[model samples]
Target chain A: MTSSDNTERLVHVPLGERAYDILIGPGLIGRAGGEISTRIKGRKAAIVTDEHVGALYLDPLMDSLQTDGIEAVSISLPPGEKTKSFDSLTKVCDVLLEARIERNDTVIALGGGVIGDLTGFAAGIVRRGVRFVQIPTSLLSQVDSSVGGKTGINTRHGKNLVGIFNQPDLVLADTDVLNTLSEREFRAGYAEVAKYGLIDKPDFFEWLENNWKEVFSGGAARIEAIATSCQAKADVVVADERENGRRALLNLGHTFGHALEAATEYDSRRLVHGEGVSIGMVLAHQFSARLNLASPDDAARVEAHLKAVGLPTRIDEIPGELPSTEFLMDAIAQDKKVKGGKLTFILTRGIGQSFVADDVPASEVISFLEEKRKK
Target chain B: MTSSDNTERLVHVPLGERAYDILIGPGLIGRAGGEISTRIKGRKAAIVTDEHVGALYLDPLMDSLQTDGIEAVSISLPPGEKTKSFDSLTKVCDVLLEARIERNDTVIALGGGVIGDLTGFAAGIVRRGVRFVQIPTSLLSQVDSSVGGKTGINTRHGKNLVGIFNQPDLVLADTDVLNTLSEREFRAGYAEVAKYGLIDKPDFFEWLENNWKEVFSGGAARIEAIATSCQAKADVVVADERENGRRALLNLGHTFGHALEAATEYDSRRLVHGEGVSIGMVLAHQFSARLNLASPDDAARVEAHLKAVGLPTRIDEIPGELPSTEFLMDAIAQDKKVKGGKLTFILTRGIGQSFVADDVPASEVISFLEEKRKK
Candidate 1:
């Protein structure tokens, strides 16, 4: 609608008692303390951030809350995915408990998706359940990771192997934080924006293709574009907060994306989520073509667009040696999609349309990966 | 109610997305696989039991599922409160992931409160959220823990420090399992049953007082009593699943109970949950008297009945030097009741009616505990 409405969009996560809002827009992080304080009654707040984000913004944010006369205690966890482990969760809970955090007090998760996921999951378990807010500071967190109710910690087996879908009381996605990310990191987030169109919403994808530069250049259009993608995700999540039916469509590239992340051992130095997602998207296109769900031309356009935007659209660009097709299938098969031991794949029916294809044989998946490896 | 309806009462957990049914009646656990299979939409099942339960009844339960032609896998963890640590959670997740579990596959949690809590928490974190069936093998789990969607593991800071409110598709409470429990364990479970009455159902407490001997002696009324307690819990949980309002009533004695658990380091041998709850109930009664919210006679009845049932109704009965009022206050301060560092104590106006008294001063709580201690 209007320019004012552009400033915020509320995502209603549907969990009844534990249900919460994902507040998206600029300047949200600053106002988050006051907004969340209302939901948690008069309880004091705890902020869980990484050292990197803490050093840059913690004091300023705390000042914003103190200006509103809100009391907040901050606990800075180590930066990186490694911090999303059980040991870290314990340390955070210890801090919260020692700080005298009650069920009514809130935990504010500040930083990227890893921080948000870890803090939210910790909130879920602290004294059985505590309210939390997400002030996601990275591009990956802003458009994708922060919007969904998915919160978790990494395990020895894989990333997000231990966690819960504990939604935040409110999610504050301030685009201003994106300035802190590097150029490569900024472009990497575009992969998720591109995914909205590939999975559903063809027009948005076309708009992204036209306005990719503006979105990455950090302008008004960039914020607007991200807000639209969030709206699409929020609408889907509101309908199926637990990823039951229509929400499954949102995982267009995640099956491949997760496997890619696992194959790289979740190493940020070699692979960023957005980057893996970009390559995973290309593989999805190939998988769709193999299943006759999309034409070869559609696959080519998908690859061309990603490459043009500086996204890795090829498996070769990925650092690790390709695991056997069977190994890849084994990893994918271990995904939550496997019901009754049959793997469920989110396949595309041309651009902007995707459906869950559960009956697809595992052999087909293995062979498809084999073909991609040979090429 | 007619005879058939008398045999069962279904209380719906109002989570909408994570919503589930609490099936209360006799012969629930044996037929649980069939009832849960319909909700989960899969024939393959995993039964997460503890060694204590597996050695006793896992076979007959497996036979029941196999009879229905449902393929089942059983994974048993060691028995005890300690086995519910992070290490055990990892082991459980590994088993489920390695077994190629899908989103639709059901995990049947079979054992006491520990197994139910660990299994349910495992199910919640494994793949974000999955279908779980609670086959409560203890009086505590059947009456209180199983029905609530709350599932979590404990951290060093406290019991149930890391968890989520993950509801099960079905809660199957078979009275037969109580046969395996010692009298002390059974009495511990009764403390929770008494809580239902202390919070909002005075009539149920009256019923328990009259029938305590019969239920403890293992009469048919035991089945009805357990089912009725679950029905009351389910009704309240369905309305307020998140412990925001009516659900807080369920924590009637938990604040004191948790403090005692922490004081004893969660050693069931030193202080069972019911014994702690019984003592907590006495402490709550004393606080009620001090606040002039309830009669001293009412407090006496609370203590007398607990003692009659072989439960410790006073802190002195606990075999250890009770922590100072300050230490207990510190534990309660970190409880789920604290808001802005102020604690909410659930006090009774009378039996069957309770209100959260958040304005209660921490110093008053200390004085009340000391008064009870001197007595």
Candidate 2:
């Protein structure tokens, strides 16, 4: 993995008139000001980051933005998923409005998924919408949430149930930031990187299986993984920006993943989002096998690769006592993906071959979960 | 307007794939379900309305929907601007998700602007987005809000600071519903109708001066007024859906109107949105005249016509003591239209000739308001 190779990868999300670019590189954070100035031109920026990320990379980002005479006012919040709440969104929006940011002015989201989502959503609704830039700091965000136009905050009901599809003008996926991530956090991000491969790219999945360690080491391998994941996402998102069909494929593991997160009451200490996806992806394969949609060997292969990467591949892998199968069933029923009370899962026919199975019988899912609880 | 003429006056909002028809006619409410069912096809419907409108029309709408085998569940809230709040939006979204409404399923907004704005925003964010229909009942909504894709709820910061521009699959503006509105409400709506002509249709404004009485009486005049206004809005919005350039012309009176509404604390009893716009429209003309952008004769004509139609055309017409000019100035600065601390107003050259005026000096606006306050 080399800086020269990684710096050249660019993923374009073609949204007709609203299209944008995702640049994957080793030093984009240091080059962000020049990168952003060309896109927005003469407009000021409001950089929104979390305290944790601010402590790590805010100064560098500010300095980079200043390089092109791009003066940016920065706001840092307490880090974590809880920070992506309506109150936080409101506070950010008021600051932007009070500052009288113009329609062309930029709002730079300079953290992971939480900051990216919260800031992007604010940018979308402020004065109806302003241009936004995403500088994702974590492997998970760089590979997933940052590329997609979906931005939102949590609600009393669930995660991301209330949000709009607000694409960013530019996404700077700087791989240099990944070095700051803890091993646990890095592995969580790997789950999503592995997701794109599992969704359709068998060759890519096989690649991750071989280079998983190199990716963790951070350099060319990590940048390639992020760029590949973003390109895969950009392709699906371009084809189905509103998630009518192919976009659902990107949520391959999210259905069961979301249910597990709900069961854990979203206590990241018990089970983080990427871990839920890791387990959910494995369950998706196992469920496919149970229904004769795929071979048991294929399911096992998927599970083994996740375990090799140290990701949770089963429900019991979660810490602490789990909720009842009925509770999990209720969570699945409550999933935003459920169309007309029927279960819809991105089930697989084989590795990297997924399809949206509309109206999968709920009774069947319940029975399968019951069997899995015993294991 | 006659049913035949009103039905014939369909305004097409052309936004590529998101384009939809706004049907303005008598008894469209009774035919809403059938009309909607034809477009969405085999989808369930969730009709979100207000108590006032629900008590009058929900059963008929439900029965109409059932006629086409489009089963619908309905929720009704208290009627007014207060209904358009984030808490109310959350309540509506939870209900739709709880009902397991699919992405393709339709959520019908079945009341005036408040319900339409609240429900459309809820539909926009729920599951990223869902198909929606707006059956606007009030004159204000019929001629204005329902035609455009501006869906939002008010916040502590300002009105519509938090929302998405989510267009509806269809909008049924039943002229029959206008009969239920009070004379004051009807007059308020007429202000917007007169607005389109003032914005760029001298002939249409001249026509309104002649037809104001008939428009209030409701028949051919009512439907024609609504449909024409929608067409004006459609033309502007289709050209600039995000209000970047040409669309700002649609806010001809809104900046001043919104400030006045804020001054009154949004007390509908003192001044409804339409009335606020009525005064604001008059103020806009006077300001233009004062700035030598337009003539005093043009300002007088605007005031005279509005007064004849029974809309408040002067600052003193607003009931109760007005806020200080400084307080009013704060509201204007906080306007979503203000870009980079510079006031952006739609100023007129003459009747049917308006242009976007960016960076208007705030001192000028304050002095203008001071003169108006004394009168």
Candidate 3:
């Protein structure tokens, strides 16, 4: 349905009775007030977002909800990765409880991955979990973070070290917010879109290669691309909502990407999530080649595609001692996907053909990373 | 299957792929060292427990693991409800990671509900959830907290405000450990045993009522009771692990129980979890009566049964301003089972039947509580 300048398309993530909807389109943010007001069935609600997004949209969002006669308040954190820590989560819960948010009242997550993750985690913890809605304002969030039920903040030990698989009752992805993003930010977001192709949708990758220019320029195809990407994510999430088997494939580039973000301090100026993901995908392709799982030509082709879209395909963009092979391997070993001490890596044999390899020994990963470092 | 001086039968919760064993028997604590050594798959492990529990079992438990060549360390917190705060969780994560505990390693939660909740929460957040084993030392824990995948610590605003539903790899319930418990502590554990009946298993509750003296006197049935209770819990969890439906009925007394615990400063000396639950069940029965959903005579019988078993059945013993109706109502509204701002309370329609009521208004609950106070 169209609301003024906004449109809505719902992607259903099948999780049995716990299934949820990812509502995609512009003006979805303003519609959040009515959608949540009707769905949440609570008189009271709280909006948890970062300062930047809150300052930009919190008033309008709250006003729209208030127009529905729903009591709404916003708790904004300083916009950064630091806001995704335990202390920040505790503070959010404090504000929520102080405002007397009943467990039935929805927690609105506004902003990018950081806000969505922290808000979801906070909602998960408060009284062992409360309902929440995701209002993703960033491209990285609209297609990826907003669709998954994964929510958590980082700990000093590592990123997303604390969190849960708490799904949101609804996800409102407003493409209009893309107007605020820079060209680099827009490209950074495509990393995840490309991810779908690398892991499970090679045909989509061909489509992406064909439409990269128009999508980059925010053409009509851009909205459909974003919505379709979310649908892809939603479909996989519904099948493996808890990241048991099929879900691990979604981490095609995340292992390497997360390590890059860790080394680069998770700063947009140095390494946006999308950029790290781009480099990570390249590393995965290279690693696949070193293991003889895929050909070097496959790596070169993927690199060419990312480069054509202005995404980073190399690790040297930031000047930091590429963490020792031991460090990255160790971090990957501690990944959430590890089970019974077996580390599983989501590696691609070719576009749209990825597999989980738990037998990829630590020593082999280290040796492969070392080869890349030497080159 | 035999261990040195085994006095109990270990019935493992058979979740197939998510399987975990429950070690039920006497003198299991002293043998916990060997049991844990045999079950854990890794060498580096962290034992997260509270101060009181640590002082009691830490030395023996660590010595056992060490004997098995498992390098183990522990992070202990002050023994109380407040220790479950986020600050303590951060501390535990820091110490565990500092100990170089790997994702392949396991965490042993040693204590009552508080420790299980805190350690489990830490494990879930530590590298996106690690393997944990519940070594429940108290009867309350052995029968309730240790079996379910529910794990989390509390926040200042409420009890169990921050947590996750992460199950353990094993649950070692050593009945011999109950020998160390105070008379009051021992009785507090029975509150949950009674809950199995209120939820769905009336036969079990009937058995408990018939053998309260034997169960309390530490009869041989004690081991069977613990195992049976774990089995009951397992069956429900396997059917609906995340508490979306029938599982929530297991929270028969928790709505009022949590409110009672919150009113008691989370201090065991004042109001243990079992005691709170005992009183809570009575209130729930009364609430059922107030709504004409159950007979008032059934409420009295439940209270009498609890009193006969040396459990608390009155709010007057809570030693507070009886917790304002609004406060209790607010806490109930913030319960995890709430949906769309409507609180769901598990109310008994008869001695062995319970159903969830979502439309119960706050005013009705307060008036019913006031009438109980007058009575």
The top-ranked prediction according to DockQ is 1
Error of 1 at A10 (Å): 7.6
Question: What is the C-alpha lDDT profile of model 2 across A180-263, one tens digit per residue?
Answer: 889999999999988899899999999888888888897777778888899899998888887778888988889999999999
- State, as a TM-score between 0 and 1, how close model 2 is to the true structure: 0.91
- Candidate number that wins on DockQ, 1 or 2: 1
Off by over 4 Å in 1: A1-43, A75-79, A257-271, A286-292, A319-321, A361-375, B1-39, B198-203, B253-270, B286-292, B315-334, B351-354, B361-371
lDDT of 2: 0.87
- Candidate 1 docking classification: medium
Write candidate 1's Cα lDDT for B1-375 as tens digits: 112233555666666766777766667667765786566676777889988889987998898888777788889888898888888887898887676555677788999889999999888878776678888888999898898787877766667766777888888777777887988889889988888888887887888888888778764677767777887888888888767777888888888988988788777678877888888887888789888989988888888888888888877778877777788888898775565666888898777778878788877888778877786
Can you give the lDDT of residue B72 in candidate 3?
A: 82
Rank candidates by lDDT, best first.
2, 3, 1
Clashing pairs in 2: A1-A220, B1-B219, B1-B220, B1-B221
lDDT of each: 0.79, 0.87, 0.80
lDDT of 2 by residue, B138-227 (tens): 898888999879998887767887778999999998888888889998888888899999999999998888888888997887778788
TM-score of every prediction relative to native: 0.87, 0.91, 0.84
In terms of lDDT, the best-performing candidate is: 2
| Model 3: per-residue Cα lDDT over A1-375, one tens digit each | 112332456787777656787777678777777888778777888898887888889988888888888898788899888888878888998888777776677788989999999998888777667778888988889889888788887766677766777888888888888888888888898889988888888888888888888677663667767877998898888778767688888888888888777666666678888998899999999889888889899899899999998888887765555666677776676665666567678887887888888777877777777776776
